[model samples]
Target: MSIWEMLAVFAAGISAGTINTIVGSGTLITFPVLLATGLPPVTATVSNALGLIPGSISGAIGYRKELEGQRPRVLKLTVGALVGGLTGATLLLALPSTAFETIVPVLVALALLLVILQPRISKAVQSRRARTGTPAHPDGGPLLFIGLTLASVYGGYFTAAQGIIYLSLMGMLVDDTMQRLNAVKNVLAAIVNSIAALFFLFVADFDWTAVVLIAVGSALGGQIGAKVGRRLSPAFLRALIVTVGTAAIVQLVLR
Candidate 1:
């Protein structure tokens, strides 16, 4: 890769790390950049997935305070995530790239819609919980498990707006503040990506140069996101998600 391409990948990594930490669709940033760098689609996806793992970890650590008392929740959801991730990764290897090419644009569009609607959905959930006197549980229940599993499958496959899907589900079902749910989203997303990355490490062809560039950049970006993201208004963050997610859809469709 040329110096310019390397710099571009690094910059994309930083942006992806920060966005992933704050929201969940950082893949939308890094994946396209990887493609532009001349990597094949599957190879780029694998490298991007592996490269972002460290950033995801860093972001999760940054939100450790919010993670308090959430161990049971994390543990309960992990099994489904692991299974879904493994399944998705295996499918990625087994299926033709054309399959994903046809499906992912729809997924990206759905994710964008979810991001746009999240606030209203969260308010409605909160209202229902208040009327029913429903107490919040750390464990998000079987429905959440199922929802997460499905989302993780998508994360394993492409992962552009998986975070939005997670946030939407968690926000409605978990009865928690968005901040706490964001932390949970990070951990769960990390789990999905990590599992997929492990599979790719053994089974896929990847570019180490891209991985290293993204990892280093994303790590730093994760810290920055954790520190700064908590201060932003939910409306602002939702707008950002919508904007980036829309861009991802356009890129996927136009490609």
Candidate 2:
């Protein structure tokens, strides 16, 4: 890639990392940026997955405190996440774009709706949970493996706003603090991207220079984002999702 492409990817990585750290829709930022650079849609998607792995890791680590007391939960759910992510990455590698093209926008729109309603949904969950007088541990955390697995699969494949899906699912099916749930979400998200990145490095096209720059930018952004994440209002991220997501959809449709 050219120097300009390197710069854009790096910038996108930082933005994505920060957003991931704060709100969990970082891919919605970088994926389109890569597409604008003339990469094929799936290629851009995979390359963006590779570039964002480090950022996801950094964000996961930054939220480690929230992961406490979740070992059993993580253990049970991570298997599904890992396996499903591998499958998702393989699907991306094996299938051509035609298979996913029609479905991609639908997924993005779902993510947008999830982000848009996250606050109200989360609040309502908390309120209902408070009145329920028991952890939603019915059938032991709801056996949400299928949902988690599917979510991870999506993350590995496209990963636009996988966090919103994660947040929404955990809110519904799992009995955990929102903070802890979000921590799990970040870790699992990284796992998906990490698996996809591994597959891409050995089997798919990549631009290592751009990946390096993006990783560095993402590293710094993750730290900064995690440090002051709580300061931002939901309105800010919602505005971002609407503006950026709408723009991305428009560009894709126009293309």
Query: Best by TM-score, which number?
Result: 1
Candidate 1 weakest lDDT stretch, 10 residues: 110-119
Model 2 lDDT, full chain set: 0.73
Q: What would the TM-scores of all predictions be? A: 0.91, 0.81
What is the per-residue lDDT of model 1 for residues 103-148, given as tens digits with 9 covering 90 to 100?
7778768767766776787678778779999866657788889988
User: Which residue segments of model 2 deviate by more than 4 Å?
Assistant: 108-135, 138-143, 232-255
Best model per lDDT: 1
| Steric collisions counted per model | 0, 0
Question: What tens digits encode model 2's per-residue C-alpha lDDT throughout 172-225?
Answer: 565455566767877888888888788888888876666777788788777776
* Clashing residue pairs in candidate 1 (N, C-alpha, C atoms within 3 angstroms): none
For candidate 2, which ten residues in a row score worst on lDDT?
Answer: 134-143
RMSD of each: 2.0, 3.4
* lDDT values for all models: 0.86, 0.73
Local lDDT at 77 for model 2: 79
